[model samples]
Target chain A: MIILSPLGWLGRSTLYFLAATGRITLFALQAFSHIFRPPWYPRELFNALMQIGWLSLPVVGMTALFTGGALALQIYSGGSRFNAEAVVPQIVAIGMVRELGPVMAGLMIAARVTSSIAAEIATMKVTEQIDALVTLSTDPMKYLVAPRVLAALLTVPVLVGVGDIIGIAGGYTVAVQSLGFNPAAYLQNTVDFLEPLDIISSLAKGAAFGVIAAMMGCYFGMASGRGAMGVGRATKDSVETAAVLILAANFALTGVFFSL
Target chain B: MIRMENVTKSFGQKHVLRGLDLEIPRGTSMVIIGGSGTGKSVALKCVLGLIQPDSGKILVDGKDARGGDRDAFLARFGMLFQGGALFDSLPVWQNVAFRLLRGRLKRPQAEAREIAVDKLRRVGLTPDVADLLPAELSGGMQKRVGLARAIAADPEIIFFDEPTTGLDPIMSGVINDLIREIVVEMGATAMTITHDMTSVRAIADNVAMLHDGVIQWTGPVADMDASGDPYLEQFIHGRAEGPIEAVR
Candidate 1:
């Protein structure tokens, strides 16, 4: 065997890393192909809806409530500098509807669901459950990835819509109590500042973020290395990738909505 | 009726299979023996089309199995995984009847549950275990569940990957007898990969030894005792000192 020095070892490690990334990309492509095929699993899709959608609502709602409350406080503190406290209603309404609601929900899901999906599937993989699926003449991609991606696509927008409403209500509560704003007038101003375009944009962001998070989780899980250490690595990597990608996509989407 | 022609598979720089060829005749049990990472499992997977070979032809019943109708081709085979690979989220009956519920074989829930229960009974499990999750079962029970699932569909071909790994001696013997009984009764072709000599003695009609990315020796089970290849002798005896290196 050719002995590798420290520098050579580093180089070899980098090469292996790149190769694994390429392999993962290829696997993702194969999975995507199954999406366009027939033999869809309606039951699997329903199960995913329960896992990624209904079960996730409480966490998403709670995160939105607290974030909305905090945003209102921050805006009130900043707006007082210019006697611009009157702008609080429009700013909070617009901010929550356009960015904070969807982004916060997406990040929270990245923390909760992404790591969970990755760890669960990665462990199944290490233990050879995926091979059993193949032997049973079942496509694991169709059974595992399709339902998840579809659930993420369909449910996240709904989650965002709910988050937006709860967030606006949170802002309303804080504005009325601590900021000495009239309840009815604050609500009206909040309503006046919001547009159909802002709501659509938030929902759109939610769907995209949801798909990215699930895809990252499934991709990392299916490509996980051999043992418990490998499954742990996959979970961490999936969450990190989902969080970073959500932020990046959020920025790009913001630029898209606001630029033109 | 499985045939592999000059099959080779490589993961980057390391070659797992080097122009390997194998055939399992119809209605016979062929056991492939090898140490870990010796590509025994990979070869079985290639035949199942779970892993595509780099360059080779795999035929099941004289048709190209590699790129044909994958589901249909797979439907003709059953497999018992080394780890019993049952779906933890599903109950035992659903796991056993997975294919029956999902594909063209879709049946009503009640019927599927009944079939699943019958299959469980065939593996000596009770109907009460049907509603329990795989996680609730012991390792041996889980293996039985996996075995029950494998034979539930009663395919013409079966593949068993280390069917006796991580089991007590009595449980392993039970599993071996179960496998033998199923293969003989159903008149199905079987391909088994294991390092367990006892399993080979219990289940194989023909034995093939895989080492160094190729079949080192192959013969009828009766000839295994006297074939006299040093490598085969060393492996069958489980000697620490042998020409076979311990690395893989």
Candidate 2:
């Protein structure tokens, strides 16, 4: 019995994980269907967009700026060992556009938007506002989850695009002002090194990450237990799950776009 | 009219409602009283189709509650939740006019607001409170606002869950009287669930006692004191030494 205990624990954990994954998939599919259906709430959708997109700009922009500068500095320092310091511009541009920008923006959003969505929705559930919506003949899925998911889906990619440009600019400022690199030459190298596929992959990854973040938030929230503790747990779990899924998705999307 | 026959619900092994049978005739008020967790809310949810029963039938106006267009079915009902459950994001008037501003009952914003204000006035609230958020209101005021919202659409049936749970005696009495007046004025069928004896007395034409997942006693409010059922006697008299186990 002692020896089998470990196996039993593993089996239970695996089952729980599978069940959670299935529930999330079903929820995502339902929310997605509602997005295309009638009885849409434009006011709710616009509110979600403002909250998840317009409100998220400063943090995403700042993170990208600092990250790009640090990337340029690191590449320059390492390349100097091999007398290849000139590779800094190309590497920084490619790095920011192909990988760092979307992932960073996604993680930031997971921290900001996912936690906010989870806490808000879980509180609503606990307070019976969700039930109130149902009694009023408003489907919570269409009024709440669909609007949020759609907003994140439409806006996160745009945020990613913006982040990539800001990141490249950060690298440019660092290289030109502090590293004694020629400004025009640095810009040329940066632009020349980035392919169209790199930009597309970045934006695509952003969309996937956005959906995961919003879906995890809504799923955890709808499944939240009762009381303040339940709301707190939902918010924490949502952010953690969104962060992990965003990173995993970034890797998978990278492979899809660049493996061949 | 609403009816529940042989309704049973269980969460795992804990049966909340077991073989429950109940009926509420049109244009009458029925209040179910019970101890906490005695399936009062569960039965109500089953009737509203918010929760499905494991076995049994629920009929609303002689039609199966579970079948047909959910929107149309829901349109006939209004619910005032226990905690008031006003939308925190919307203003008082918007919350009150929620039903009229959207869906099949859609109306112009101006018309909806006007109706909301009129309902508020009927519920003893001022029109000045319209633009304020629900959080700004006191608990009693919030309950009144919820009541206003419930009657805003002039639903044929209204359900009040613990209508005076968190209020002082005077406020509770006020709310109880308002509920009674509103139901009578609209000629609407009403169902309320609460353990508050005062509220039960004020709001019920017919009274039902629920215990052990079923109706233990039921009759007109006049016969409640003399019903002589151990559960009903124990619950009404607030005695801890009767058929109910206090530790539960």
**Top-scoring candidate (DockQ):** 2
Off by over 4 Å in 1: A1-36
> Model 2 in CAPRI terms: which quality?
high
Which candidate number would show the highest TM-score if scored against the true structure?
2
Query: For candidate 1, lDDT tens digit of each residue in B1-248?
Result: 88888999999999999988888999999999988899999999888877889998888889998766777888888899999999999999999998888786778888988999999998899999999999999999999999889988888998999999999999999999999998999999999999999999999999999988888899999999998888899899998789887654
Report the lDDT tens digits of candidate 1 across residue range A1-260.
Answer: 35658779899999988996787677667767877797898888898889888999999999888888888888999999988888888988889889999999899888888998899889989988988887887777888987888788899989989998898888888989988999999988888878889998999999999988888889999989999999999999999989998999999999999975
Q: For model 1, what is the alpha-carbon lDDT of residue A173? A: 86
Best by lDDT: 2
Q: Which 10 successive residues of model 2 chain A have the least lDDT summed?
A: A251-260
Alpha carbon RMSD to native, model 2: 0.9
Per residue, candidate 2 scores C-alpha lDDT tens digits across A10-39 of: 999999999989989999999999999989
The DockQ figures for the candidates are 0.77, 0.91
Q: Per-residue CA lDDT of candidate 2, range B1-248, in tens?
A: 89999999999999999999999999999999999999999999999888899999999988999999999999999999999999999999999999999999999999999999999999999999999999999999999999999999999999999999989999999999999999999999999999999999999999999998999999999999999899899999999898899984
